[model samples]
Target: MRGDGSTPPRIPGPPVRGDGVEAIVAAGGLHNYQLELHAEYGPVVRFPLPGADLAVSVADPVLLEATAAINKRPEALFEFLTPLQESGNLQTLPAEEHIPWRRVMLSVLAGRPSHEAHFARFAELTSRTADRWADRAGDEPVELQKDLSELSLRMICEYALAGGLEPEEPGRVVAAFEDVLTEYLARLYQTDAPGTEDERRARAEEALTFLRATVDRVLAAYAERDDGPPERSDLVAALVAAGESPARIRDTVLMTLLAAHHTTGVAISWTLYLLARHPDAAERAAAEVDAVLGDRAAPDYGDLKRLTYLDMVLKEAMRLYPPGPYGAREATEDLTLGEYTVPAGTTIFYPFWAVHMNPEHWPDPEVFDPERFTPEASAGRHRLAYIPFGIGPRSCEGATLAMVEAELVLAMLLKRFRFRPAADRTITPIERFVLWAAEDIPMHLTPR
Candidate 1:
């Protein structure tokens, strides 16, 4: 009962939105819609979604911080992951219930042995991918994002399935996921007639079911076979250690796959774009990789930590294009953020991706600047201001794993070749599924 508006028009049916509303919100996709909203409402816009629902878009960091601190699950949708989480049986499903569980998961990840295993596999994947890129060191333009998307998916599957699946299977899974996601995006922006939205939702749901079943079938066999803990680290080991049920474990693994597949690919794509645009930075990264890795040798676990500029470039790229582009949560009860108070059942959509690029948080936000992340220069900056992995306790669990993999792969490729944007490059983004360039990104690669 806090804000002012003229009885907001009712939009109907599962948020079956139109191009006009989309345009009002920047119809190109969520990212653009958000930017448009921010520009129009100054970070506090009340949007009426379909089905008589209301979502208040917010970007005020202080409000975000307060809500994130006092809020618990049920209020935060993240607590209810989809499908499996809908059943709500986890110990930490609620904020109070989640403390102990979060500690356990955190302990598992924080464990030295776990980190060692992760780094070991990271090294193996680095070498394998380097070998692939090296073979095509000539005129091929490596779609850094596409390649990593597949690699991250493959690596995650290996970590979960113990490396038994054929190489081509993951591609099929990714395609199915892409189809489902694209349909969902269309549903979000389209003003479909009554039953049409239901049909689209059904398709999206089926796509998810398909993926979930595939993971279950694999995990079922993985469960019976007694493979002692993998010597090299991976998420699969975490699954075994957690002693999760087959269905819950499958959901978690697929969730992990989706997380690993999208975020890492987005970052990798941006990194390549920045590197290609700024040849000086690319050359410096190449030099660093060459000097650190040496001729005919791949980077080791130790070398990953030493790639300073490469790390900065990755950070900068993420700053520009965050993987978790936006976030949404419903207010379970009345609450006040900044100057506004929202009522119970109000939805809030906050995009850290847009905040990262806010002119206030970033200087020349659009420009690629690796120096912004240098330890000394970055010492005084707002760490929260540049959260590609997001912030609070909800930050990505696989963050460290993803970053190490991205930097190592990017550095290895740069060590061997230079990639440039293709002729007449059309980097149109399709918000259908993941925010990816609509036309397949074409880049030309040349040997260093």
Candidate 2:
């Protein structure tokens, strides 16, 4: 922070407690704090938190493009995600190990298989849930976040894991994941040193071990079944067909769970919240759903595609409240960017929440306007500006699958029940592994 708007002659962070740095990071949330810092101290500043380590936020696109795309990732800071990524059977691989595993994931998540009964299962679960929700067609306050999380949990459990789901268990994994994930995000974004970094890794591994054991039992059963042609249309079958190793099966299953359940659930939850709060958007979405599915018909895959307006509605919702909020990378070597020199070990964070809401990038950043995404209007915006899934080689592997799931589930719910905000619902976003509402997104549902 200098007299002019230049990033001070040197970065102004690495402060763990005193000097007001830690307080800012702890108070404002991660990405939001980045914007607050940039607004006061200029586009780039160093934040020093003892447990998190030294880092810089670069609002400059050219510098970020050169650095983030330079083939490096934040290994230490993201180590917190390691246990979950590995044990849950998802993305624990380094760049090299990730190659084969990711390819295998692609084989299953590719669009062709999505059209089969897997997609049918998605629609089925959603429709069944809608039927239950529809029966409550009054001012009864339903927690949109809770509802979507349950609905998404069902879809992920049934489709990605074994078909028969116990209502109590997935939450064991989901709750652990969210809790640890929240702590990890706090450590990464707010701490100055890597004090408990290793300790946190140990806890993450413990949680991973629990999930891995669960996945292993499932895998053993999968192996013992030698009777007849496999009839399951879930992720296990998909992974078995993909030839995922027994050890990695848990990781992939959990990874897909994270992708399918955690992120998409938040997106759907927020979409419902936004639409419910903004009647115009909800009405527009309801209109589309009604036209496409009428009253009682469940939307087929093609029918889901025809609900283009809902897509805009979803996009705007994600733009306002991305399920996964920010992106991070580590500087492998000392790098020079516009007016600043970054240390080799510096972890670079891209405050995507800031990017999406920038006045320069998004006009009227706070308003809910689905029309902003019309094919013509969205023509030339920066491709990276709206990274709900992420970008580059590590972008969400199950993105296509998730989108189909989201569009279908949302279309079905809006068509079946209209949502309006319920008590104790607040729009304030919280960063807990993902961008989520601080409280349950409460809403009242009325049958349409």
Candidate 3:
């Protein structure tokens, strides 16, 4: 209620009927639905989300600040991930439990030492992918998402579980993880694919068993090591040292693998896709890469800082198409957002894509201009206006590492090849765990 004693403004939205599934479906998906809802009803809209009884979406960055401290996520929305976790669902953990866990994660994932420790392996993996792309340069267009997803998975494997597997084990791990994710995602989206539900579930279970055992093998190897744990930068080592249970450790690794790979992969792929559409940005990015690495093929850990334009390009691309388009938090107390008051227990939906497109903060929102991120342009802008990673305590802890991996890969790829969209393919954005292309982004690569 406002101090003026007049009734607060009623949050405007479409008439709430049924579970809102039909409305969401009609709008294409939740991402598009949010865009339409905000466009028609303004930044804050009360809508019936499928999983929650009452949901209010906030797209205004300034208004978003009011909900930032709410640490609890709506459990029903993330319930699908329960099967992958053993100790408990990491995504919906209570704030007390999540806080310490997040600290440990930040210590390893956010530190420069951790990134530098893993940089060489990351660079090597990117170079190998580039070599494979080089082989097929002119023959056929390359599927960026599929190949880059695998590469990101491999990089996370190296970062999470340092040096415990055999030479052939990494490939097996990648295959097993893919099997696990394929089944889970298919179930979530109800998309028909090559196999029966029972068959896919069995395969996912088998892959899950292998993955857990693999983590155990690494732990066993760590236990047997005469030298102490390699470094605090190693994720597994850090978790173990912090007295986390083995089950929690395994869940952490699985969750890390799940969160890190596809998002980073799609991020790089989308950046390249945008660059392909706008050749001028691509040229500027490429020229920056050239200046940063005159003779070297890849940027070192220190060099990522120097590739400022490439960084800006990546940030802008994410603004246009964030990897995870929306997120939700359950309000723990009555919250005042502008003139309206939201009661406790309301599901506060975060329409990240819509926030990026909000004309109030980002003028000419649809324009693919990288200069929006330059220092002068970014000055005095709302902090939450461009949240590619997400907002507040529940935000991605891997944000820093993701940037390093992306910039390095971009530098390596941009230095070696020029990416142009394939002639006939239409790249449509769809939400599968992340913002993915319905048909993978196919690009024609020519050696630079």
Candidate 4:
């Protein structure tokens, strides 16, 4: 086990075929690769990345505390985002810059005032999507991811832009954003060749231009409006009031959209999937919403706090299928994690899915059980045991916002419709910036 500060055992994976790149590929991407390594080699496993040095994977919550305060991220790992940032990629910003930027973000994103201000629009956007679903015939499958992604995009645009985007704006923004991401993700996987790479780059450029132009229009409209509060709650307004440049504000809005898009949608999708598969939990969640909302079509901001069971269900769902599966941190100083001492500059991979699956923390980890998050059951557990949104400084800035959105959407849908897993459908979870199903998560919705 090498408990004496020496390097942890290297995963004896598939004969190491040249820096273990081939082995990692064969293991089915980094998410599955880490799961296999942790299961076989224990909490901390050393493995080689294709073009990098040995990386350490940490699954044990206790060990995570040692690196919890790390402020640096592996630049190479986050290079995929460079194109989106002109000042700097948010993921790899230096601590001095990151702290202030994060402070500004948290001021708006994590504030109760900001959430309350946006809750009405969030509910409105959700209702619009649900209204479309209501029009579908019974037994028709709803494409959970696609529908919810658009819903999330709408919610974020409304929140970021202040008065909400035009009725036709979301579709164009969503399409352009997806076009940009499709090519960026392809490059991340090293799948683009010179010829195709150029094409992808061109497409990405066009899409980015469209997105920036859209943001410019929104900002221009904001400038021309007189209805904003003396103290701004909208992110763009807040950023501008703080004296940030137009380009910086635009980048911030785009980054927030990108972060919230698939993550919030997939989170809602997974929560629905889990609740559908576990009707008892779904019923309890619905009952809680009913009791709390009481004839109200959707929950008000204050009502969110009172929906306890819904909170537990969402937490448990995230434990099982975190929106973003994993994160990495670079050690700035030598640190000892349990019995092992890791050197500075080492890239420590926090495999959050594995951490959530640790039997020591979660009994029958794969089983969908909302009770796992009940206040009683959750007490005294490792703080890092459930890190779906990650931990420390680099955690999702909009986490509170994401949760508010998820709970509101879940309550509305479950209150009006019953979600049932479509028969004969298979869901394959893959890492696509976030953990997402390779195919749409199809579910039948019947009126409750």
lDDT of 4 by residue, 72-135 (tens): 9988878877787776788898999888888889999999998998899889889989999989
lDDT of 4 at 90: 80
Report the poorest 10 consecutive residues by lDDT, candidate 2.
84-93
TM-score for predicted model 2 compared with the true structure: 0.84
Which parts of model 3 have CA positions greater than 4 angstroms off?
1-4, 163-200
lDDT of 1 at 387: 62
TM-score for each predicted model, relative to the true structure:
0.82, 0.84, 0.94, 0.93
Order of all candidates by lDDT, from best down to worst? 3, 4, 2, 1
Best by TM-score: 3
- The models' CA-based lDDT, in order, is 0.65, 0.69, 0.89, 0.84
Report the Cα lDDT for candidate 1. Answer: 0.65
Q: Show where candidate 2 strays beyond 4 Å.
A: 1-21, 24-26, 49-52, 60-63, 85-92, 179-210, 226-244, 333-344
Ordered by TM-score, highest first, the candidates read 3, 4, 2, 1
- Cα displacement (angstroms), candidate 4, residue 440, comes to 1.0
Give me the displacement of residue 28 in model 2, in angstroms.
Answer: 3.4
Global Cα lDDT for candidate 2: 0.69
- Candidate 1 on 114-188: residue-level lDDT in tens? 555555565576667657877776655667666778777776666556655567777777776775655644444
